[model samples]
Target chain A: MWPPGPRGQPRRVAPTIMNDTLLTVENLKTYFFTERGVFKSVDDVSFTVPRGKTVGIVGESGSGKSVTALSILRLVSAPGKIVGGRVMVSCRGVLQYAPTGTVDLLTLEESEMRRFRGGKIAMIFQEPMTSLNPVFTIGDQIEEAVALHQKELNEAQRWEQVLEVLRLVRIPDPERAARSYPHELSGGMRQRAMIAIALGCRPEILIADEPTTALDVTVQAQVLELLRELRERLGMSLILITHDLGVVAEQADEVIVMYAGKIVEQGTVRQIFSHPRHPYTRALLEALPTFHTTGRLRTIPGSVPSLAALPRGCSFQERCDRVQQRCREEDPELMVMGEGQVARCFFPEL
Target chain B: MGVYLFKRLLLIIPTFLGITLITFLIIQMAPGSPVSLKIQQMGGEGIRTETVSKAVIEQTKKLYGLDQPIHVQYLQWIKRLATFNFGDSYKDHRPVLTKIREALPVTLLLNFISIFLIYLISIPLGIFSALKSRTLLDQAVTVILFILYSLPSFWVAMILIIYLGGGEYLNLFPVAGISSQGVGELTRWGQFGNVLWHLVLPIIVLTYGGFAFLARLSRAQLLEVIRQDYIRTARAKGLSESAVILKHALRNSLIPLITLSGTLLPAMIGGSVVVEQIFSIPGMGKLGFEAVLSRDYPTVMAIAAIEALLTLVGILVSDLMYVWVDPRISFEGM
Candidate 1:
């Protein structure tokens, strides 16, 4: 048993994952040192992905969903730094920090982090059309992910593994699909190829960052179904980052709604959809054009606040329909409510 | 691919004919054929030709076969060319093909070696400078390459010769030609080294502008490519920094470099007139220049035909290179 730390201190990294929580992100902050001063791109955002389940991080463009995913991988590029907090990945033998098996990804050396990435946790990006290298065959690109991480596999076995992944993603004739270039395939097939590449290493955590945004609607449904089935079959923790609530509702077991670089609400998919608490979350649900509603789509009053010049208290304060005096003075923390649900609000709408 | 090649080969015939025809016409339009020049240079008896005898002038034209009309002469030239005879140089009374065979390889060697070095050095520098954009190293590369690019190659050649090949300085390499006097007596390897030793100054001059231009182009191209979404995907795949760059980013950046191939061969052979003249290396550029000044019509036409053919082939090779560099490009039509 590991010795307990001093009392009252916020545990930056929960020593290791139990059977349930596969990944824990604690008080995560990622800042960009730009000419326009320090931009808090992902400030005070934290979430956990339960094992064998999907966690959807939903946000509009520039709401830090992608940045948060990048931060978890410690891939925040130059001029951007993870200035605070920890991303505790479940350290198997692949990413052995200690015999206790926990690695604070933020603290891992770049080389160490590299071993964790693509080996233990791989990311499939948005823009499937562009994410795959144009010059390489889809099979070679998939095999590359395996080659870079799975050093134990021989060339023949790696080829087999790549073909196997292609088949897993329902790519018909895995041999031909592997030989096809990114431009040679349709957008949907390219997304499937991208998933094949992501799954090539048999990663414990697979981050699908807007994986279907550039795909067609029908293809989108198919791709989402494929991801859900893959997660169930492999028992891999999945993080689905998207701007589509419909995607979250269908695929996510847990959902985190982010606005202006901070999580505004967190709950089960049903709770967030049926009993949405935060004003921003409620506005987002109302804005969705549904077959159930006949009138014009209800638009949110104003645009999401820019992270550079966020207002004095709540980021949503300028646009909130029920803005209070206390909401003007200070930002509220996520207050826990029913069954692991929490929302950042001075007055919960529910 | 075969069809494309056949189509390209079909294009070259008319292109060759057009180039040869234009060169022949341009030379004919100018006053004085090679016979007339030879006659005048034969001295005082020829210039005041009536005194010497009119029959002698007529005999002179007959002797050189110069009395034929331009169209008849073109037919004869083409007939000879079909038999792989490029005709004899009127200036030297030597076969044009023989002269080209002797001189063209020197230019090709110099240009090819310089080009090889240019690509070898420039590509890595370009990648490094791009990866370090907005940093001191990038700015330094920009300033240095700009300065090198701005300095005229002719001037650079002269400066290199004076500093590296003159008595006042090092005299480390031969200032002219491509081999020492006893090159033939030396062993084969020694012969090559001797020629390379003589080539140092000219090679340096030839490579300076090329490497600078290529590096700047590659930097611009790589900067654009590495910013693409796929490049991010490459990094996110947990590739090492070098792999992200050299493997993932390099091929896309090289697409622009392939565009330069259409001009590379002809530019190497034809554009080296100054360097060849300054070094007196006896390459095609100098041969073409001397052929032009002496009104050696056959030699000039032969050089022009070869240059035009090379340019067309260069274009074909460029297309092939595109198919190789990017899988998105294929020779087969959709």
Candidate 2:
């Protein structure tokens, strides 16, 4: 067990579903040391994902959604470091620290972390154009991933696995596509290839960071469905990071809504979507253009607060329509609302 | 691709002709004349009055083919140039083509060996510096390479000669010429060994400058490529840092480096003139230098033509390599 201190103090609550918990991130803070100063991109935040369930971290750009995912993999490189947090991941009944898991991804002797990265956890990036190597054929790249993770597999088996995953991601003519370079394929195909690569190793957790954002809307729908199908078939947990609330509705069982590097609302998908508590969540819901409404979608009046020079009280106070005098003086802690729902706000809508 | 190559090949004609024409005019316009130099050398200190007469000048002009019209001579040179016949050297009385052919192999061999060594040493060093960028190793390499690059080739060559050429210390390598003795008597391996040994000083001087430039360029290119998204993807896919660097970043980085390497060919050839002079190696550079000093118009023009051709060939090879390295580049479009 890690030493208990102000920095590593555990939130006094019963650990939830230990057996099913695949990844647990507690009060994670990631800071970037820039020329100006240290910018806390991912301030204190926490979330958990059960095995075989998809958890969506929804936020607009710069909301630290992607940073949270990156921090989990310990992929946040220089200028950025996880100053404080415990990322506990349960692997085969053993609870290991996730960020610096039992292998200490942050401090993991490079060799050990190298083993954990592609083998235990893998990530799919946002832009497929920039994500895949243009010079190498898709087949060679996927085979390399397989070979890196499953070193015991013979060359023939590795090729077979690559073809199989390529098929799993529903890439048409897997063999032909495998030989093609990144530019030869359309954007959707490239994204599918990326997913195929991430799924190649059957990782315990797959971090899909806006994997479908670059594709066309129809293609985005299909990619999302493909992800759902893969997750279901493989029985793997997924952390889907996106700004699209619609994607969360379709793909996620639970949702964590982040605003300005802090989680504003955390609950089951139905609870957060139907009866959102935080004022920022309500603003987000209002901002979503709906077929049921004919008028212009309501816009949040002001921008999210800057992390460096945040206001004394709520970070979203300047933009909140329901802000009170007390709200300007004191920041509210995350408090439990109804069953399985938590909102960080002093006042919650019934 | 074929069409691109055809167009490039066609462009070479005007380019070569332009170079040949300019070289001819430049040689003619220069203050010294090969004819006068020849006459002066042949006449000697106590020349007879009859030998120094206008009749002797006319005879010298006729003997050297300078009596022909300038345009007609240019045409003749072009006609021979098309067939790779570079006329005769005024200084040695040997055919210019034969002289160039004899000297070219030595220059080519030296440049080739120096380039090979540069790559062998620089690439790993470049990659290492890039990987450990901002570290002491990177700082040390950057400083050393910068110093080496700034140093003059002749100065470096002189230092090598002084230290290795038995300057009160040790005689580790041969001081001059490409071969130890006559070329025919040396066995095949012995000949190769002799050439290599003779090349040590020149290669060191050339490699010091060349390796520094290439390493710095490669390191910069690699730093950019490493920051690219594909490299990040490779790492995310669980590839070891070494795998990400070698398989992903390095190849993409080499694309720009290939273009740089192509441009460096002419530079290497240019640098070899000083190198050849310092080592006393009988290469094209030395021949060209001698031709310039002695006012050998034909030899100078021929060397100029060869240099132009080499530059074109280097660019052509680089364009071709682009297709090989990146499939997306359509040569026909260019």
Candidate 3:
């Protein structure tokens, strides 16, 4: 829900005393129909993000975190289809369904999707170097994005808008940076340029899929801070998908833990950190190398199960220390563990 | 850049000399001699009073400086070639370089026109096929191009002559010769137009195969560029598909295509020998072929030297262009 207002300040409305759900995804299942048969990449993933907040999705590689983001954007490559799901976005006093309703993104014709993408929702890709076209100057790219969505603006106005967004992303020497090509910019500058392009339109939702994974630790911290400041200042919803727990701890208001193509845990930042019910989530927390830890650090035993041959019960049963016979016989569904917290497990640990 | 040009220029010396040496040795060692062939021709005409005696042939060779040792002849030829002198033709008693120079412009014109036509037709065709890959248009183009690429140039030339030459229903093009009768004695513009008209068939036949090859290569390279993550990024920025293709994908794809074009440049100058023969165009290939048949060592050696120089120039130009298109490339490494 992008409200037409001044650039940086959040608008005030009558306090409804109820959470405003900006996006609601239900039973989202995305599959890749390959020669080897269908591989379920995102199975029954469900999450809800209230307006003006951030949702952090955390998982190891191949854990369906990135696929869920791509599925939401309907950018999954060919042979991979969003098989079953309902992604609803409430924007400008209208409800839009993803795969089944009016303007279903999964089935929307490419021309129609073009109008919504980068206009209503935008994405910041993982590798900034490969994401920006090397031939175009950063300014030209940002200006093009602005003009594509806002065709009514004149060239001078569009350029002004580009400069405004570039400054908003806190890029120094915005004027100079605009004229420089991608190869001329440092890694951090390129990443910031990507963010400027993503936020140029002031879309309803910004999906950042591991935006800082390719940056060094110092740059990662700076990028995370910029994202937090931008999110708060713009009052725009953010879906931050990453496997780094440090990133989540620093910025996420809410968290979703996915394992083997399924969301095994979801909760507020405090709920997830204070008492993680899922064994996988607990193991993930323990695996984090803290300053106190000495000798060999703890690691989750065994690798992630292949999507084609997931365990029958809990997907994490094979790696769970507290696994029982029942945990292996039946798959668990998300059960309430605390206020606004859900974990899928046979026996929730306290 | 000056250093690069200097290096390229330095390379031409050995290349020209090497070509001259190879062509001379090959022609000399071949089973026939120009004196013997001329005597045979006179004998066929009933004008021969005596066979070509070995002593006369040896005397003729001495007069022409061919009696010198191979190394001495090679050194003398190089010295003359350094001053743009190819000595004299033994058969016609004309300057060998002058004859080659007179024929070269005609060959260059035909080859240039053909290459230009090929690029004009092939680039768009290649982009269209790549954009609509696996569709009916792509399939049709692929099949047609495959046929064209596999077809012999000479056969295609003969077919064009039969269909488009005078006396046929089409009668749209000249049958043979660089100019129409009496036009050779006219103004330069008139003579140029006349030569161009006669050149049409040979140029078309020579162009078809290379057009098919370049088109396929361009389409494949464009497809690869289109698959890059940067293209997706451009699309995600809400740029139109046309802008995505033209501004982003095509520019990057041209780097490879430019390299391929450089490789194709010499082919245009070399002129397809078989095609030239079939169409009866007075190009370098036709001259080279005649020199081979008549055992004209000087003419053959001059044409080979020119060809080697043109090829080296083409390659050098292509390498320089690569740096322009992609700044990341360094010619020093090459």
Candidate 4:
């Protein structure tokens, strides 16, 4: 049971009393009911974000990685409903306001859900150019987020909080950057401002949905480094959703490889990279061109199937190099191959 | 901005000249002169038709300065315009300035009221429809607005007159003119009410099309704006839906409406010609209609010049308003 408090007042968890698992998502299914057909964007996704650690979700486009993040936050809009899910967020973490027990975010009322969003858990989107409101200055937008979550703060205090977050995000000139519009800043700085907005409430969990995807190569590295530094310093769990495997290798402790709206493989970063289990994961790892890769980069045989019209058995059977009769006949459930490693394949590599 | 406005004002001189010069030349080439028209009227009145001979026509033409070369007449008219002199109306020989001044207020009052109503009603209508877009209520509103938009104003005015005015069915409102005959005897407020009552049908006819069109435009613009990424950002910030739409989306959606307001200037000054005629209101539209019918060159030219100036001013105002709503545009470079 949560603390017996009315709305807008979340139970406070002490900073030092940390929970090992900050978030657990169970059987989450978000489907988009469009005119053409129902898109099973995030079908039965299950994951957890441990405190002060990074969980990377990697997949090609339309693989439901981004939708999983949105479902956790309940930010999916019209036509895309979270049909079934339990996004249980543990309050006893480094967060100051998370309740003493886990709360199901999906079932919370809109007002309560609003309090959780940008308060206990925040998100930074991919397109920094468009993420910040163009009409508002950086400081104003951040101040708005702060004012919404931190109700007791006065205007001056909210402004101070904005400047503090800007400084925390390593903006060179906080005062100048605060006064400038989104268009006035570079892509990197805009992303930093976006991060500052997320950091406005000192969230325990930060969801970076392709945070560095829109930046230059150097800027991408810088942003990822900043995120890494911010996570470590703030003791916040991160859900890094991206298609770049190199970023996962550099930044993630755990990796989830998704295909056709389902997780094909999930394991420790080293375990999944060094010894991939599922054929799709193996193909994805093989496709990555390392320094020792002698020939041309390996390409996956086929693309992901449309979620509306997936094959009868395994969704990846058409794309699998090691496909067989069993794979074509029956769908495979996730099987535990080793400690902390799960693969969905009828004939997983030994 | 000041420098830009000064330059715009200076540019108006040439534009004014071009408008007046072309109008004067077209009038000269037109067939109906005051003298021939007068002669025809005299013949129709059963007066001394044979006595209105070539000598009498020549004297009348010379008196009215129509016998001069076209270029000389244009130059003379331009010279008079420099002194703010619009000469006299050929219909009644009244000073064009006095006639326009009398008619200008009525047109301005009616148009300003219509414009005010259009904005007041359509903006909320647009925002509501957009918020409820694709719902049955929104679809119904759309159908109703489209019907209103498609119906011609004159036809609507006639229907309104027959149904709501002093027709056989209702007789609730006055059928013609902007005021009752005994309005001067009433208190000021009473006089105002009488005028407004008489203006109801005409104003309705004038404003229905405008509001319907503007509501649709604002709905479309707001829809596009609410779909933009920044609106999503606002929502992600934990602001309520109202705050996101009213605060974030409304201002961004107003650019199209502001553009339409600029183009509305000519219509504002010219007044609704058919509506004014149907109502028999002594507004600028009715005045200009009579002037053109009687070939009153001075009155027509004066009205054209004033409408042109207001149109230029309207464009400038809307541009300045754009800067107010959206800081991205500035007049400095222009």
Instruction: Indicate the DockQ of the complex predicted as candidate 3.
Output: 0.54
**Per-prediction interface RMSD in Å:** 1.0, 1.0, 1.6, 1.3
In the range B1-334, model 2's lDDT, one tens digit per residue, is: 7887999999988887887798898888888887778667766766654557788788878877788988988988888877878878888789998898899988888888888888888888899999999999899999998898899988888887888888876789887998787866988988888888888888888888777878988899899999988888888876878878998999998887776567667667777998888889999889999999999878998999888888888888887888888866767676
- Candidate 3 lDDT over B1-334, as tens digits, reads 6777798889877776777788777777889877677668778889653866779778867776878888798888888887989877767889987888778887877777887888899888999999999899999999999998999877787788888885655899987877888995879988888888888887788788887887988899899988887887787776778999999999888787777677575676665677777777677888888888888878888888878877888888888888778755655633
lDDT of 1 by residue, A1-350 (tens): 11112344423344556766778899999988988877888999999998888999998898999999999998788788999998887654443322344658887667667776777788999889878889889988999888887777999999999999999999999999988889989999999998898898778889999989988899999999999999999889899999999999999999999998999999999999999999899999998878899979998877877678888898889999999899999988999867979999989986
Question: Better model by DockQ, 3 or 4?
Answer: 4
**Taking the true A–B contacts (Cα pairs closer than 8 Å), what share appears in each candidate?**
0.78, 0.73, 0.45, 0.43
Better of 2 and 3 by lDDT: 2
Writing each residue's lDDT as its tens digit, candidate 4 over B169-241 gives 8989887898988789999999999999988888898888876788988899999998787777777777888
TM-score head-to-head 2 vs 3, winner: 2
Q: Which pairs clash in the backbone of model 3? A: none
Regions more than 4 Å wrong, model 2 = A1-17, A93-109, B42-44, B48-51, B182-187, B332-334
Model 1 residue A158 lDDT score: 97
TM-score of each predicted structure versus truth: 0.93, 0.92, 0.88, 0.94
What are the candidates' individual DockQ scores? 0.72, 0.72, 0.54, 0.60
Pairs in clash, predicted candidate 1: none
Show where candidate 4 strays beyond 4 Å. Answer: A1-19, A93-98, A292-295, B48-50
Candidate 3, after superposition: displacement of residue B64 in Å?
2.1
